[model samples]
Target: MRSTPRKLSLTGLVALTATSALLLTACTDASQSGTDGSTASTDGESSAAPSFDPSTIEVDEAAAALLPEDIASAGVLTVGSNTEYAPAEFIGEDGQTPVGFDIDTIKAVGATLGLEVEIQSADFPAIIPALGTKYDAGISSFTITEERMQEANMISFLNAGSAYAVASGNPDDIDPESLCGVTVAVQTGTIQDEDIAVQSEECEAAGEEAVDILQYESQADATTNLVGGKAQVMYADSPVIGYAVEQTGGQIEQLGDVFDAAPQGIVVAKDATDLAAAIQAALQTLMDDGTLVEVLDGWGSGDAALETAEINPSVG
Candidate 1:
């Protein structure tokens, strides 16, 4: 199954019980954040030692030359991102500024092209189809897939996997081997949501109780659900699982190992091939010069960093 960025925030769903709603909301209220910050900063990024220097980034003449002449003249890279995915893209403390590693990555890309980046916050489902029209590019942890390639150019960047987590010591006796009849929490529209649907189907096919899949709009809510004993299990992107585990302060523990690794990419418009080439070139420069790894490392996602960037690579 393909993995998508999980936005962590303990938002209380209206349908939840009054007790759970309070518990979940109280756990995490902050949204994601970032801006055209020249300094290394984030709600969780201060922990990455030896702070990254954005001022040190230099423009790549060849990469800038690849930009479409019109865009080069425009002097701004319009980017649409769903500012909800923590450590990747999300609204910051001020409630409007977009902050996260993904924001920083795109900013570095803009700097290489010597253009200002204008990050436009939009819904996750709306970001892709509007590319080339509504936005110049997208970099919100889009997993490179054959289907996505048909819709837009997918430039490979990071490799990430999915993982499951349960309350510490598995106090609920949750079994990853068979989730039949167990509560499983996942963010809406994520690959984990799709995977759990299949698992639920399998249980019914085998005449066993199907999994009680709990869909939350925010991963923080899902993670909080698991913490509050409302869910027996929860699965998300490996980095997201790690972040949730850390943010929750030992309330949850990883269950089993991470699985289903895949390449996540930056989405560019199909018709804007020139812009796509320019983005790929800027990205390659980042990968080669260590800027990409430095930024990701600060976010605890350095291990998922890719050494090379590719365009529309064949998915396994």
Candidate 2:
């Protein structure tokens, strides 16, 4: 982790547009919901349809061999995810299945480890704290930050950058360079929340107006607010903003270039080195075999693919 200001993580362009149809809505409560993984979402059409069977991903005996005895015996890798970000992971149209690139990627990892994958919907902030107990893993697009590494092992796999978007036509005329005193919207419990706090503090320190940050439980709500002309701007992972822009039919536009490019990781318990090693090995197998690119590229996110996966990878 670098000493720079902590950035906010994982919010996206509006998956909900006034002009589009969709299967699910944003959920913000602390309580969690159950998903059967029974269906796929219809909202994210940005990528070519998945061309391969996720269940058919080949198992790597060497990778599977690294799993902890208890996990190996259970034969299931249960993942907890904040399933509201489009294109990465979100609830499918059926509202029961977890869908998105992240979901597919993890499912592939599980298949390689010869384990069934089960994903549960959780609030963005609640997923990590419940790791190792409620969830064996967290597959949310967890931006690798120094702070997070202290609590849980973060294995770097995919690379993503942060970006901002505003209502179409510069409606608020907001400037991303100086967000102080602006009304900014973001999802709760994300790195963005922490980032905005730090930005707001900078505003006060400079005797300027602090950013009126509106933290929503779901990016969907924050997006709705932005489109509804309530919030001036929003920021999140780049893929999400791109999804939102494409889905919204010109309702919003990216405010600036994507910045703070960083690797995202699968979160494993800090003490669960065995599990982490297994996951890293399984990911490497996929990468080596070209399965990683095939899966993510099918989702239109192949651009962010990493050549290698490192456990607790060093980040600045």
Candidate 3:
């Protein structure tokens, strides 16, 4: 018989939550320093970059109130998201229920604005197209890129960076340089994809066979390949790798510290200025009241937090 695909179900949600609570308690009490021993140079001093500024931007209530007449009358906003990204967006063990830092943050924002929020799950790359007349916005763990910014309006949220995951015991200590001739799996069209492309170029320049880059539609797929021994390393966001490692009971180890920072955000149609403004305002309220951090912390993503910022550079 073919085995069933690994999926999160409601029962799994309960188990995961129970496991998370225990892990959180241990983590909180460990007293060990929080730093992962990673540091970078800044003005001759080495320090870790601060997470995204979750409060540096705000929305003008007057402008927000000027939302399109249709939107104001409807009083509901439909958001597009892909639940494959854990800690950002994901389905609870109760497969039908959505739960994650992103879900909580968006729900809290909607509550603050008295707007009904609906989540529509779509493929990661299809989110932008799903917006506009059909969907009002998307809050997937989408990273802001110059190319994508040209197609939609992105409201910056979390700061992320690429990292690699390898089987436990870290047999190779898998650094980017170490990946020269190995097969590395990455999600297509993501910053991790770009990072691998850069690595491939560097490998070619060094006379090594450029790393064999394998593309997967989702992190879970890539991770499956890694566990099945089809791939040597998986390239993805650090937080994502961390979550996967946690879920696997440390069966995997993340290596080669953050290489590049990617700023994640919500995307709206180029013409949804009013909707974007309202969202910006709502996010500000969440930040000020500490609800944003609380929601993220609840999901074991205390590291994936962001500050509110104004919606400038209108989508149109």
Candidate 3 residue-wise lDDT, 268-300, digit = tens: 898777777777777767666676777766655
State in Å the error of residue 269, model 1: 1.3
Clashes of 3: 11
RMSD of each: 6.0, 5.8, 11.2
Model 3 regions lying over 4 Å from their true place: 1-66, 312-316
Q: Name the best candidate (by lDDT).
A: 2
Give the Å error, residue 53, model 3.
Answer: 24
Instruction: Encode model 2's per-residue lDDT on 193-267: one tens digit a residue.
Output: 777789999999999999999877666666656665667888677777776665555667888788888888899
> In model 3, what is the error at residue 264, expressed in angstroms?
1.3
Cα distance off (Å), candidate 2, residue 81: 0.4
Tell me the TM-score of model 3: 0.75
Which rank order by lDDT, best down to worst? 2, 1, 3
List candidate 2 stretches off by more than 4 Å: 1-13, 16-52
Give candidate 1 regions above 4 Å deviation.
1-53
lDDT score, candidate 2, position 49: 23
Error of 1 at 121 (Å): 2.0
Highest TM-score: give the candidate number.
2
